[model samples]
Target: MSITPQSPASPAPYGAWASPISAALVAAGATPLSSLALGPDGDLYWLAGRASEAGRQTLQRRHGARTDEVTPLPLNVRTRVHEYGGGAYAVHGDTVYFSHFADNRLYCRGGDAEAAPFTAPGRQRFADFVVDAARQRLIAVREQHPDDPASHAQPANALCAVGLPGSAAAGAETVLASGHDFYSSPRLSPDGRMLAWLTWDHPRMPWQGTELWLAAVLEGGTLGTPLCIAGGPQESICQPEWAPDGRLYFVSDRSGFWNLYRHRDAGGPADAICPMEAEFGSPHWTFGNAMYGFASAQEIVCTYIDKGVSRLARLDIAGGRLAAIATPYEEIRELRVGRGRGAGFLALLGGSPTIPLELARIDLSSGELEVLAHSIADTPDLGYLSVPQSISYPSASGRTAHAFFYPPANQDMQAPEDSKPPVIVISHGGPTSMTVNTLKLATQFWTSRGFGVLDVNYGGSTGFGRAYRDALQGQWAIVDVEDCIAGAQYLVQHGMADGERLIIRGGSAGGLTTLCALTFHDVFKLGASYYGVSDLKGLDQDSHKFESHYNEYLIAPAPHADALYQARSPINHTDRLARPMIFFQGLDDKVVPPQQSESMVQALKRRGVPVAYVALEGEGHGFRKAENIIRTLEAELYFYQRMFGLPTAGAHAAVEIHNL
Candidate 1:
């Protein structure tokens, strides 16, 4: 539901207008959605972050008309296993097993008992969990950190099983599989005879390549030689699952796009179930991402990405016929296919340009939609919303970059008659993850205030074919920076934005891109980086084991990487930074820690470039606290207004610029 559209009485300066969309409103409405699990008897389970609770993730379930919390306070149901952890919890009947963020220990709840630890409180962390019902244990990807904090930078990863006792296993865990740099998607066959999981080595992220291995579930919770069923160094596989008939099914990108494949017999080559140009899987940034599953033996429910938009469909395994399921969602994050009322259907964590995060169930044959949970409780007036346009433009080095463009939209006001809106070029954090079309209040907050936004899927982003994604290899800063510049230039030339007031912003990997752009080029007048990377050398040393050697692929291998570090790092070349910029950093961020942003700010402050810095306490790589989010948003708005010489009437933040 949206508010009725109305026009204002007169025009005002682009950055000085009175907006109905406030920073607090944006922070309060920006509730993100993640991981979903379904139970038998048509029960719905999912994770929701409360804004008032400082964005603490709570696991909630719906059984019949009753919806209640499964995870109580003081017990944050989250995993630190890859930092951006997903698949943090799973349910088996009325019992639930989850990872406690505070201790990095496994806990078990439900069955009329309070949640208690089942795994020891140590550096060992677990995620991507599945219940091994026959053995009464949990199979998960465990990251074993060294007892010494100094060596904690490197941890050994493996597929291990934890007993389901209500207390710590007394430092006991069965090592089911090991020697892989990373592992995910541990699934068991319906008969519980076979176990399947995906693993990939370092230097090759999960999206670059992975192997699907299957072995017999022997006695003592493990055993049997595992055979490589599908995928290799050249192919990337994701979400290995078992069909009702016990056939191994997974997603593979052998055809340049992630698509569905199935292995019918043991030691036999996997066959493509449905071949298409669209992608059936996304980059493995987080654990427990499922794009498709078995609706029945002959039918499969799935979601595919084409031109940066997601589509849901049903595929007939026998005839190879695919039927599109109509829905308003352009992005489907997590999905589950199970029996509801004894009928097969699909449930998806979905959203659109005008809708917030929603849990929807669609009947397989009827395509009927029933939305179960809305992340944002309040229904915003739709008149002020800016619908995203799927756009692509010619990029540097004769390549193409995709983006979602949202024009300035406001129901109560408009810009001057001849004034073009200021464009904000947003670079998504994942140099590997693609930008999807989902409604975000943070993005809407700017657009509804007469600002255009271009969220770029640069060369290194996923969702496009492998070739386009690989183009970023050995050209991390080069290709990404070029695509961002080209996007702003295109919009300016098309009269969609004012070239003088163009702004660029990004966080994490995107933060590095933003710093690089401001250092080497002068396309935009202002820039902002949220816990951004300013030094390439520091990033490699500060990153986790999952991405310890990622620089080898993004820039260059070591020995040669030393030279690229100096050449690409913005911190080393602050002498070239002339544009005004503001930086937001989390003091506790392990990835791209405080020193990275602090060094850049110190250099820019002394070099006569107008710069402001805001550091928050108890914050991580991304802002989870409501007050910090509100502070950063308000501070950024104030910085932009101050830089543009606009009168700040209701601005709440007062930042000090050393060289303004």
Candidate 2:
């Protein structure tokens, strides 16, 4: 046999230049971090790679210490990659239940576990779940596609339940209650006799307004008539939890800031357990849990944000006093409190002057903090990574905004003796989401390659409070675009980046900002949008049940929507775009639809501007396949290099640049 010499993987030109270096680099599909639930036997249950080849939604069980004691829950298989709806997993007794997104069915693992589809998939999209083991039923929020004309105005959603260990055709699903446009936080009473959940309707996101409902479970496992326990049109309630003592506890924003409220009986008014001007529930935008667990019926432990700082707080329900359990950390991503156990774990990020996001575990009672993990990088001997400096920039309306700036640094690339490197301004999606000092390999990817990065927490972003988040009301495209422009200008004025080489990139709502910025302003010379919204009106009409009416606040009400939608949509104004841009979209995306990107690409082509468009099939809203991610990053790097007249050292696709 002839031995063939293996070719080496191509190395990055600016090797070892990345800052806040780590050993654990982000794999193509690797998430920065995730939360896990501990099983009754102390086995850890977490979602690993199982749903798709690009990403796995496996229910992993880790036994014993650091040895090879980890075993995935039986019946791990690739389901759907995007919009499968099921991600969060819950444990009841020895059985493990999780949502199967691909089939829109629920599955269980334990005792002769054969992964069979439980609930029928199509009529509704299933989300976060609560298992009533004794009752052999599962309570979940069902987001159903609308059916009638009025349904189009307000999408249909309801708190529903289904029998576990049953067949999909068995018709096991029971509608607990209806009239909810969106529903979440389903909690079953410890005795399995009562159910408590949260719901909010159209023209309002969950954070803006929500109601808490409690219902008795009938003998046949159907829900009795729901009683509105707490909240109204102006109030927002979240994370409804049933204490072991039969008391219903939830977080409410009744006092302008989110605080904890408890309802002892079916007809009683909710009593404020923890009251403060700090937020207990984060802005209801992302699909992750915020407040993890309740310690006791009276003592509550949760995460709260005050003035952009995330802290762990312990609430004394009887005294109405809140104590800061853990000192402020850089960011608290997830918190989990164990039942009857004073000791709980927290997934924390401590941003340092030299590190990006350092993951640590916090013990509530002892107040002991331990570093559990840190990101690792492949390169070595790189100069210490510079920490992001949090700064504020003035918006177009003269209001100060927040952002984090990471100066350019790389071990190999020394700026031509005197020239400052280029800068990349990033806008986070959700228009409601905020960028934190969390560890993100994508940011390092640019910075490590000799580029400065500005992660902007523009107006309408959360973590600062509601008023700040509501600032983007009726000003989505304008406020977001102005903030990005102002942030880049601030960097240029302060000599942080080369003004002539400024670039901007964003995804989803952030992508809208990117398109609007490039079209409305001449500051950025290059831009990239990932599965972004190009037509605001298109979104209002075609979006999913969860966000069907989101544009009502972001833009304007539906009756007067045509003019405002056209004005805010970048697709309509593509004729004014002069900067070189790249676009990425998922064919299966139901939120923004592929037409959003296609329209923009066609408009730019007609306008004779330089633009490149790439669409990934079998994906939705976001790219998940490893090959697609790698290709996107590589293509983007090449696009930037060619646009900026930088030296290309390797073979890359000859992309067709329109109107260049």
By TM-score, the best candidate is 1
lDDT against the true structure, per candidate, is 0.85, 0.70
Which residues of candidate 2, in runs, are more than 4 Å off? 1-25, 32-35, 49-52, 66-87, 111-114, 120-122, 144-156, 166-171, 264-269, 286-288, 320-329, 340-384
Tens-place lDDT digits, model 1, residues 254-329: 9998988888684556788888888999888888888888888888888898878889888999888898889999
Clashes of each: 4, 17
* Candidate 2 per-residue lDDT over residues 56-103, each given as its tens digit: 445545453431213244433323211334335577666676665555
Give TM-scores for every candidate, taking all chains together and pairing residue i with residue i.
0.97, 0.87
Candidate 1, lDDT over the whole model: 0.85
- lDDT of candidate 1 at residue 528, scale 0 to 100: 97
Worst 10-residue stretch by lDDT in candidate 2? 1-10
